[model samples]
Target: MRCPFCGNLETQVKDSRPSEDGAAIRRRRSCQECNGRFTTFERVQLRELMIVKRSGRRTPFDRTKLERSIAIATRKRPVDQEQVDRMVSGIVRELESMGETDIQSEVVGELVMKALRSLDVVAYVRYASVYRDFRETSDFAKFLGDEGLSDNEDT
Candidate 1:
């Protein structure tokens, strides 16, 4: 592995173990030139995936982007990094298991919504506000009403 600190091509793996979720192998390495240490993860790639956007544009699927979006949604919530990582890994596995190289953006969004709804309702609402593109308070009200986020009893 290349050294991220000094750009050295030579690095020695000091330790290797399965990740918390067992979805990846975590390796601790040290650069020969700089002697800097860092960690890297190795995961099994079932296939090269592509995402089809709403505008008909196609782009390579990025796990970082998916994780970042989920992280943003779950930030300051009770959800921890392990849970988020597991969720991301599970979603990726599901997508790969679908046996399709090309996946729709809408499908990805729905998957995130479902995962968040189960993980944390506040995070779910936060993600929905952006994903659903709420324009006003009424939009939130309507969404909360539809999704059962709002209280059922009258004041």
Candidate 2:
């Protein structure tokens, strides 16, 4: 692979290991020209999946969107970036395994919420607030009081 920093085509792999989740392999490389080091991920690319939005519009699945949402929800939490990455990968794998080209947006949202809920309640609530569009205090309260919600006061 070309070096990202120096645009050098020649690079040496310093290390290679499977990612924690085993979905991809992470390679540490050093540019022969500039000695710059960087990491790259090699993963299996699955078939494209389309998301059916609430407005009845279909769009290609966007991984960045899922990552961004998870990042926002996990902000300031004990969760680490690797955990977030694994969660996103798991969700994508689950969706693809269903063999559905078009998945409802609600399904995607629920997947995120479910993953976040297990990671951290505060994160779960933060994600749910935006995904579910909680406008009123009651809406927030109901979510907090939901049966599946953690009863921890800190959340």
Candidate 3:
């Protein structure tokens, strides 16, 4: 592996173990030239999954992009990084197990909303605002009502 710190070509693996979810292998490595340490993860790619956007455009599924969106929703909240990772992994697993190479972007958005809803209400609302494209306060009011929540609920 290439050392990220010094751009060294050679690196030595000091330790290896399965991640908490058992979906990836975590490896601790040190750069041979600089002695800088870093961690890496290895995951199995079952197949190429494509995301079909609302515009009818097809693009490859990106886990990082999903993570970023979730992070933004959970920002400044009590949610932790591990929970976000688990949510992303769970969604990917669900998508892969469906036995479909192409999935709708709407499906992904709904899954995220579901996950965030259970994790944190604030994060859920934050994500829903963007995903549902709320243009005004009534949009949020309607969503809250539909979800059995009152707009006066304590934040």
Candidate 4:
């Protein structure tokens, strides 16, 4: 690695440690020329995963976009922030396990739906309504009918 201080090409690693997330290696290095010390982090560069939309359009995967949607759906709900964080982490893990650079947006949505369904029914419905673009009340009714959720669960 090139030294950041004097653009020296030679450097020696003084120490190394794994980052808390375990996704990267933190290394302390000293420049051979200037004796300047600096820290460098090395992380595995994952391949760009393309999200294939329902309209056959491909877009880059965005974590913030996913978080925002889930957050909006979970607003005013009893679900804790930790649960949301875990749900997001689980989805990322599942996606990474696919071992493919390209994934369908529908697949991501379905994963989130399944996770949210067991976590909070209200949040699940909110997310589904936005995701499915429910045109009328009948759409929600159909979902309720299909899932067998009724007024009894509301209390």
Best by the TM-score measure: 1
Of the two candidates 1 and 2, the one with more favorable TM-score, higher being better, is 1
Q: Please give the distance, in angstroms, between residue 151's alpha carbon in candidate 2 and its true position after superposition.
A: 6.3
Model 1 lowest lDDT segment of ten: 146-155
Model 3, range 53-123, lDDT digits (tens) per residue?
A: 99999999999999999999999999999999999999999999989999999999999999999999999
Q: After superposition, how far is residue 105 of candidate 4 from its true place, in Å?
A: 0.8
Off by over 4 Å in 2: 147-155
Per-residue error at 115 for model 3, in Å?
1.0
lDDT of 1 by residue, 1-155 (tens): 88999999999999999999999999999999989999999999999999999999999999999999998999999899999999999999999999999999999999999999999888898899999999999999999889877776331
TM-score of 1: 0.96
Best by lDDT: 3
Ranked candidates, highest lDDT first:
3, 1, 2, 4
Candidate order (TM-score): 1, 3, 2, 4
* Tens-place lDDT digits, model 4, residues 1-155: 99988998999999999855565588999999999999987755466778999899999988779878899999999987768866876787788789998899999999999999998999999999988899999999998888888767772
Q: Flag regions of model 1 displaced more than 4 Å.
A: 152-155
Q: Pick out the ten consecutive residues of candidate 2 with the lowest summed lDDT.
A: 146-155
* Higher-scoring candidate on TM-score, 2 or 4: 2
| Candidate 3, number of clashes | 0
Clashing residue pairs in candidate 3 are none
RMSD of each: 2.0, 2.3, 1.5, 6.4
